[model samples]
Target: MPVRHFDFFTAERRLVHTNPISLLKDTRLGIEGNHWLRKLLQNHVKEPAVVAMGGIPLGLRAAIERELDLLK
Candidate 1:
């Protein structure tokens, strides 16, 4: 079995990333939540754009679903 583990780190201050690709490449790409990966991606996205793309929250939801689909 692939033994999975999780841990969390809180920067003294919140960190923001304008470029997610670079952020992902950064070694600190770790999170505590089971959906941390998805949450991180959602956080980097500007909320206004999310609302503009569609009044619904489907964009991130779709992205998250797509990611999970690929994992399976």
Candidate 2:
């Protein structure tokens, strides 16, 4: 699949709830109007699934998106 840039403004802010065995559990990384932040997490985290909403950034999102494959 082609890696498409996420629209921060259009995107929804949320959290990613993980299991006790999961290090990502309670690790908040969701936000709106901040594509960079979402991208950053999308790249780094194994499964960048939103669990809750919060403040997000652009640089961070970009970083995450860059490492998205690595997360997989």
Candidate 3:
């Protein structure tokens, strides 16, 4: 359920898949939660910051952990 959006484009075409934060935005943990979550798996993000996100997305947590070696 926790899937991020991805966009791939070429000279003549574009492809997009989006799964931006859903229910979280509807809760008390809205935009602020989204900002950090957006940064979670990025190459520049480090462990401490990742930890501060409070938690990871339901389905993607495992993959995120694997991608972020420190979390593994």
Candidate 4:
């Protein structure tokens, strides 16, 4: 899965392509309640390419964690 890393705080806000699984885990652990991250996930949901690559962005990761917590 291809993951794109984006830094909104930067002047250019360039995207850095990376591996999706590692990126998702890092974002899930590092960032919390970030609207930009959430927006990125939502935008990806509409496109088949993003979803096809097993894209589980911050929002989905959070949701999965929440579900696991509830199950516990």
Candidate 5:
């Protein structure tokens, strides 16, 4: 099931005094799927000095910088 659906089910279950489904330890990666990539990008953008020095194309780099500024 999708995360949103599972979240709804969990909330409903709590209201009914029932336990929510347990998170699967073994399938964590399959479920989360590299959530760290967003953090990695955010970290890179947070450091403007390093962003200016990276070898990415000027246009794409500018776009990323703009998005980072908005995120702040």
Candidate 6:
């Protein structure tokens, strides 16, 4: 058996090639960011004062409540 020398750097003084990859995106993580924005607008709908004061189109209150369905 013969021993070989290994050099960690090139003449340019940069790292020699050793590939290490990263995962930048994945499908399962989408909803980990998905819901909060919608929840913000729905917040106003949950408040009785805002709803009574005409929470936008008025019909939106019912829709938001249906979506929340918290007890179930």
The TM-score leader among the candidates is: 1
Cα lDDT tens digits for candidate 1, 7-68: 22223343533563544443654434445654546574346665467654545566667755
Ranking of models by TM-score: 1, 5, 4, 6, 2, 3
Off by over 4 Å in 6: 1-55
On TM-score, the stronger of 2 and 4 is 4
Query: What is candidate 2's lDDT per residue for 1-72, written digit by digit as tens?
Result: 423543432355533344554565567654343554444466654433334444453355556555554434
User: Where is the poorest 10-residue window by lDDT in model 4?
Assistant: 2-11
lDDT of 4 by residue, 1-72 (tens): 323443444436645455545445534453344654466456543545555676454356665566456434
What TM-score does each of the candidates earn?
Answer: 0.29, 0.20, 0.20, 0.24, 0.25, 0.23
| Residue 63 error, candidate 5, Å | 22
Structure candidate 4, residue pairs in collision: none
Ten contiguous residues minimizing lDDT sum, candidate 1: 2-11
Give the alpha carbon lDDT tens digit for every residue of 1-72 in model 5. Answer: 324455467687785453333443344323333433343455554555555787543354665567546534
TM-score of 5: 0.25
Of models 2 and 3, which has the larger TM-score? 2
Candidate with the larger TM-score of 4 and 5: 5
TM-score computed on alpha carbons, candidate 3: 0.20
**What is the C-alpha local distance difference test score of candidate 3?**
0.46
What is the lDDT of every predicted structure here?
Answer: 0.50, 0.47, 0.46, 0.50, 0.48, 0.45
What is the alpha-carbon lDDT for the whole of candidate 1?
0.50
Off by over 4 Å in 1: 1-31, 34-39, 42-56
